[model samples]
Target: MKKIILTIIYILTLSGCGLEQDSYLVRWWNGNIPTKLSDKKEKIWDICFEETKYLPENTKEEKEKADMELNNCLHEKGFWD
Candidate 1:
């Protein structure tokens, strides 16, 4: 019984860790052209797009807005420098 409990705990731990993984890319557009962005500015924009995509579908509009703000912030922060 103890071994079974330990196995279950291990599985749960692994699953929980997976939840924190960042698999999305940020973008200025809704498209998934991650490779097209070569410059640092474009990359920052893509990161914004990816982050928005990772959010829940119900808040897509909000996420998109947030992504735009992120892009602006990146530019202001001299991402191209």
Candidate 2:
């Protein structure tokens, strides 16, 4: 019984691990953008998604809003893929 409960809990935790389409981890850009040229882009991406300041509250709705805000910023800067 204990092993079964532990397995269930582990499964629940693993199920929530995923990357959203817009996530930097998912590589939204097309083709290979050299690291040299992508420094500024990387910084912006970090500020928008990786930084806690721009992440909004920890709620799902707040995260979605923040993600959209970041996507808009990237789009305005001419990054679309």
- Note the residue pairs that clash in candidate 2: none
Per-model CA lDDT versus the true structure: 0.64, 0.67
Candidate with the greatest TM-score versus the true structure: 2
In the range 2-47, model 2's lDDT, one tens digit per residue, is 9999999999778647756556644535443345537777766665
Off by over 4 Å in 2: 1-37, 43-52
- Judged by whole-model lDDT over C-alpha atoms, candidate 2 comes out at 0.67
Steric clash pairs (candidate 1): 25-50, 26-46, 26-47, 26-48, 26-49, 26-50, 27-46, 27-49, 27-50
Cα displacement (angstroms), candidate 2, residue 43, comes to 5.0
lDDT of 1 by residue, 28-74 (tens): 23464456545776777666666556545458797677767766766
